[model samples]
Target chain A: MKEHKKLPSAVIKRMPRYYRYLTTLQQMGISRISSRDLGNRMGVTASQVRHDFFSFGASGLQGYGYDVDLLRQEIRDIFGLDDLFSVIIIGAGNLGHALAKYSGFEKNGYKIAAIFDVKPEIIGERINDIEIIHLDKLQEYVQDNHVDIAALTVPEIRVLEVAKLVTDNGIKALWNFSPIELLASDDIVVENIQMIDSLMVLGYNLRTAEAKLNPN
Target chain B: MKEHKKLPSAVIKRMPRYYRYLTTLQQMGISRISSRDLGNRMGVTASQVRHDFFSFGASGLQGYGYDVDLLRQEIRDIFGLDDLFSVIIIGAGNLGHALAKYSGFEKNGYKIAAIFDVKPEIIGERINDIEIIHLDKLQEYVQDNHVDIAALTVPEIRVLEVAKLVTDNGIKALWNFSPIELLASDDIVVENIQMIDSLMVLGYNLRTAEAKLNPN
Candidate 1:
């Protein structure tokens, strides 16, 4: 995050892969690893791993892959995941309920400090021991819990209102699952994940890949 | 797909952006656009558009950016969105139901043809008018529906077993939202999307970015 060109999005995208592979190595009690071995686990060529690492800088020893603990710590620093992140979910619908209980967040270093819902039925209800609070308390909860980022799984039509709420509540970044694109300022970084659109991308790639492999 | 060197996975990732832009233009009834204009809408440098298009041996007219209709259709061909891609959702959970009703799928040329679940209460129930069939019927339903892609939003404990079923049903592609990785072959494509991991990525990036800008 120094005064320099931003980390390439592609490089940032690879952080999860690096984290996953590092986690595996740590589990095996391996302290050091070579780029080739890391590449083997990641399905990328070793040279490619080295290239990506070189692009982002790494703590790996030359010809030695990486020091397990140092590499893990270094990658965490690079990803900025070393610190705890406070997250607030902006919807308490069925999707939100599943997301609240989804253990994936805990493993990847995201702490769900609060869940927001406008539904009278869901408000005050607890899922996975996390209480669903009324949306009216969003700003207070966000400030109280030091929430830096939030994710919205609200209906498409209601996204703008919730987005405004997130901004007013001091949220810096947002992961929006609603299909509609919410307008936000340059200060507000928003990532829209239209799931169906994602499926189309993968589906199209799958077909294109299949056709290339089996030309008629 | 016609004898092109495998496009970088990164390229595959960005096709959706291009697709979205094109769709937006189509919806607006815009007939033509230039590279600069397209680049502006896509949030990429103009040169990037030219370079990315050239990678596919495709480009818009020199003076005019691209013919709206031609480019739209060509992008589809590039991404293979023209083909029918039948999708199966494993886990008839709330999230799965919301995904089934997600309008972006059919809007963008992918179809959710089947929903599989283990819960007896939900089995045979209708979701978005799509039947929530039993898990016991998965393989047969997949074959019957000619489904070739599967999305796993199941419980983490059941992920591996359900993933095995999906691949055994001859699905060439699988999307894993569970925290567990779904094992696959070089021939089969599996994209694992851990929800919480995405939140962490957002948090980490935001903090790193903020720290770099405000050296406190």
Candidate 2:
């Protein structure tokens, strides 16, 4: 893989969105797209889209727009999506099961290698062909398998412990779904899915919109 | 509710984190917190914390710090959490079922009034006491009940149609979980939970970190 220039955090955040749009365009049999059309679809200004692409050295021809496949491949490389990652779910609850069965991650190069649970009854149960193993075996599993990310879906009380267990065994990335935030060392990367926070933001927006309309 | 000064988008984004941390402090029986302490816990600078609070007219005493309960309540009011919102899930698949069974949203004042699905087999199914109704009944249900938000968990192919169905019936807020973006009118508030984007960001971070460590 070529070493790419470090992008601004704001630009890095939008890379995924650009990739998604480019993929959709590809699916619709679009071989190339002008910045104006792409920006229109993404709800951004054409100049803004050009600026973002230019920041990453992806430039369109003077008159002929960008080649969609090349731009998407560049984004895929930036996200390291070409590399497959082995993932383990730390809990087997409803959320965990949902994630295990979710094919999106697998399609995006992250595979759920196994699931761990403390419950004896469900220790051997299978979710979408992936076996649920005992939590006691997490250490052994990580040691044997090349695990890349540990998706923490344990209950709030057990989240910290499960995170510690995964990191202690050399897993460096954590995708946390529990409500609590995971404080990991500098070497570890943690991404939290704060569903309630998003919902709260939505609620706040709705309230403000209503207030604007009513004002009483 | 008192009228609040409009906050910067950055501050508004941090409000939920502050609320979560404050709730944790309250649970731990801490009635007051200095900006320094709060900032340290939230991984931000004390001045930044104070600036955010000051922007919202929440000031702490020079020596006594801020009252945690009062601060929390102010945030709650800002987020309009005091008002219970009627949320209907639009899909009854794994992710939908997980959201229905998850008790966090209910505890946070967003009630799942009902679940809607097109499948006849699971139409009358109950997830955590909330019945799954057919999608055909969505219009009548929204007409009768005060539906505040529609949680769209349907497949990508059906997202736009479902979004139109809800918004056409006067729903204003959408908490979208599908991978597609919903293009709604100016009046509608859409909050997208892009799980893949987050995972991709994490992957990019992990790759960059690995590159730094290897330096080959």
**Against the correct fold, how does model 1 do in TM-score?**
0.91
Residues B1-216, candidate 1: write the lDDT tens digits.
233556676666776777778778989999898889988776788898888777767777878778878877776776656665677788888778877877777756678887888888888888788788888987677656787688887888888888777777778899878766665576777777656556656765686658766776
lDDT of 2 at A165: 84
- DockQ top scorer: 2
Once fitted onto the true fold, the runs of candidate 1 whose alpha carbons sit more than 4 angstroms away are A1-6, A55-57, A181-185, B1-8
The docking category that best describes candidate 1 is medium
Output the worst ten-in-a-row residue range by lDDT, candidate 1 chain B: B1-10
In order, the Cα lDDT scores of the candidates are 0.75, 0.88
Clashes per candidate, residues 3 or more apart or on different chains: 6, 0
Candidate 2 Cα deviation (angstroms), residue A162: 1.0
lDDT of 2 at B216: 86
Off by over 4 Å in 2: A61-65
Per residue, candidate 2 scores C-alpha lDDT tens digits across A18-69 of: 9989999999999999999999998889999999999999999988999999
Query: What value does the lDDT take at residue B133 in candidate 2?
Result: 98
